[model samples]
Target chain A: MTALLKIDGLRKRFGGNEAVKNVSFEVNPGECVVLAGDNGAGKSTVIKMISGVYQPTDGKVYMNGALLTGKTPEAVRTAGIETIYQDLALADNLDPGLNLYLGREAVKHVLRFPYLDRKKMREDAAKVMLSLGIVVPDPAAPVREMSGGQRQAIAIARAIHWQAGIVIMDEPTAALGVPEQREVMALIERLKKQGVGIILISHNLPDIFAAADRIIVLARGVVAGERRPAETNDEEIVRMMMGATL
Target chain B: MTDNTVNGSNTNTKPGGTSFVRSLLNAWSWLFLILILGFFEIYAQTQTGSTLLFRIYNLQAISIAASQILLLGLGLTLVIVAGHIDLSIAFSTGFAAVVMALIIRTAGADAGWVTVILAMLAGLGAAALVGAVNGWLVAILNVPSFIGTLGTYGIARGAALIVAGGATVSIRNDHTRAFGNGDILGLPVPLVVAAVLTLICHYLLKHTRFGAHTYALGANRASVERAGVNVKKHLILLFILSAFTAGIGGLIYTSRFSAGAANAGEPILLYAVAAVFIGGASLTGGQGTITGTVIGAFIIAVIQFGLVFCGLPPYWQFVAVGLVIIVAVLVDQSKDRLMGGKS
Candidate 1:
């Protein structure tokens, strides 16, 4: 099967310091590609470039063979690439339904003037959360009162609701509890089943192993090595993360 | 676990119970208004041997006073909720008033209703220009709203002064005077106008996608931008809406008083901003309602009118209104703490 997302020779430079250098990767449909690295590694830079948060010094990013380079983050999202930031990028004052629809809201026309269809949006939010095995008891409550796991779930639900072809998650489970982390891993499995391509940036070894179909270790601004989980172990991946030669 | 169940039980209880309390807390401004009215009514009965709340004349007087501030606050409420301020609205009101009166005076006292309508439009147009300038400064130029609007505040003040020749411009027209003071359906014209505008604003803020984005924009601007919204355009539109409402206040000022001064909206600015805050909006944005702002305006109006009715000095009205504003903000802050800290 053809790859859903392709990053070719991505490089980023901040004045004299090169943040990301010659990183190349591809994610096929229904696959999870984890970018594993130590602190100061180029994982974030690479993802930022792909997500259009940063314009690469030199590189190309393609989704479904369409050039996505240099587009705004909003444009990239419109092209079906959703990035769930580490902060979740949620408006704390808004309820899940509003959060789910955010920039794109459902409206019903009255005398040809459109008003928010809040009831339908709320019902749909509940249905989507329920399908993901998460229950938001009060759909009307603003997301600020929600647990970290619930908030994370809401972010994922937003991506899924939009039918994103590719999802880039940056440390989605970092602030979550053990069970919540497991829930996120399960959600990843569900996304894979839905044939969504995922590029996950994670530091947790166990989580990396559990969720990734292939692991790409980055060190000193370049991919040190790439290996399938079945063909590699934790020590090898860690060594690769620490700049060990393949 | 077969399913990763979220223990929403604990979360559910907080909103279900505290929301009741939170809503009650939100209604503190209304409660304060009622409390003050009661105090004034008792004072009127015991001292003057008459009624304060029961008298139609007294209620009309208070509502008319409130109607002015309400018009100004109606738009500023949206501005503040979007995490911005429009200090220029003060002089925007004055500028519109001056322009409208000038048009009427120039057209001659016996000019037809069409002239009056054209003058009103001209007044609104001038105010919208100020709004657009404020929008361009804040949105496109990346200036802080407070400073940008403050700059325009001075400019608008100067423009009003120049347009009115540094004084009030008086007008004489039966149609304009009737519009200003006439009654409709047993309600004073100004009050009726305010009521209709209030309903429209309430619907816009509560039910429209534009309103939703305003709330989101104030809450977290980055989120709205990332959500694919044209935040710059929205900000521009917001400032224009703010100026538009203040312009209406100016139009009413000219119509009701038969004259428009360069400083017509100067004194009303403080009351308008106070009404917004007392209505439960925060400096941090992302909170507040039009209903709350309406109550807030009435609270100020009652305090001002009640103090006068109680035979206090005019200066005492300032002190009383200031005290009420402080109390309203305190209540708002505490309500935030009670609702699980800042969002």
Candidate 2:
């Protein structure tokens, strides 16, 4: 199958330091590719380049055979690549409906003047959340009032509602509880079932082993190795994460 | 991890009693306004042998005072809601007023409606220029809004003074004066303008996509940017909107008083800021409403007018307003805590 996303020899240099060097990967549709690494192993830099937060010094990213390198973060999102940062990046002061459509709000016309179509947005948000199996008791309440899992669900729902072809989650379950973590893992399974491509960045080995179809370990600024979960154990992956020879 | 029970247990854990208290706390500012009005009405009846609330003249005076502060506070409310400040508005108002008055003075006091309209646009443009500078300094240059606006405040104040040649530029336009002071459908023209502007701003802040992004911008700017928003452009527009409203204040100042001093908006700046805070906007941003700001403006106006009507010295108005602002903030903090702590 054609790759849903392809990172062609991605390389990033910050001043004299090479952050991500000669890293390449491809994510096929319906695949969960987890990027695992120790802190400062250039996992973030690689994703940042792919998400358009940072322009690659020498590399290219493609979404469905279209060049995505050098695009602005907003442009990247419009091109169907959604990145859910570790913080969830939610406006805590707004309701789920508003948060779901933060920059691109739904508008209706009254007397030829455009106004927020809040009812439509709210109903749509409700439908999306319900489909995600996330029950928000008060749709009008700000997301800040929600539990951690609910907020995570909202972030995921936002991406899904936008019909994002590729979703990059950075430590999505890091701040969640055990149950919430399970919920998030379940969400990953659902997304995979929907044929959406996912690039998950994580530190938790159990989470990586559980959610990843293929684990790509990063050591320093380069790809250490890649393995199918069925073919590798935590011990070997940990060695690869430590810059061991594949 | 059944999907059916996801977050359902914790969601219902918020007791109804606490939520009731939270709602009441949210309306604390309104309650405070009514309480002050009641106190003033009682004082007018018992001390002055007159009814305060029942008198149209007193109501008109109070509302007119509120209308002035509200004009300045309206756009500032959005700025504050978006987690920024525009201190230069004090002088932006003065600058616009002086520029308008200068144009009118040069065009001749009886320079007809066309000249007056052009002058108003020029005035608004001057204020918007100040706002753009503020946006550039804060948004693009990454200057903290407080410091950036404060710098613009000094620059605008000096510019207004220099433009006015260091004195109030007074004019005598019969049409301008009538528009400033005349009644529209039984409402004072200034009050009418303020009311109409208030409705428009309320709509902009409450019912538009721009407003939604504004709230999101304040709450989490990264969220807005990641969601494909041009945050810099939005910031620039927000500052311009702020200056635009303050410019309207300046235009009214020139027309209503027949003079546009460099310090025209200086005295009202404090009241405008107070109204915003009293309206429940936090310094940290991401919380507030236009309705709350309107009520806040009225609260300040009523206290200022009521104190004088009850024979208190004018300086007492300052002290009283200061005390009320403190109380409002304290109430706001308590409300946040009541709502299970700040988010």
Poorest 10 consecutive residues by lDDT, candidate 1 chain A: A237-246
Cα lDDT, model 2, residue A91: 93
* lDDT string, candidate 2, B106-152, tens digits: 99966999999999999999999999999999889999999999999
How good is chain A of candidate 1, measured by TM-score? 0.95
lDDT of 1 at B261: 86
In order of appearance, the predictions have TM-scores of 0.93, 0.95
**Candidate 2 local lDDT, residue A213:** 93
In model 1, residue pairs whose N, Cα or C atoms come closer than 3 Å (at least 3 residues apart or on different chains), thus clashing, are: none
The sequence of per-residue lDDT tens digits that candidate 2 reaches over residues A58-151 is: 9899999999998988789889998998899899988899888887889999999999998888888988888888777778888888877888
lDDT of 1 by residue, A80-179 (tens): 9999998887888889999999988999998987889988888889878877778776899888877777788889899889989999999988987787
Candidate 2 interface RMSD, angstroms, 1 decimal: 2.8
For each candidate, the DockQ is 0.53, 0.59
Quality of candidate 1 docking, DockQ: 0.53
Off by over 4 Å in 1: A12-18, A54-59, A65-72, A175-183, A230-234, A244-246, B1-4, B7-20, B341-343
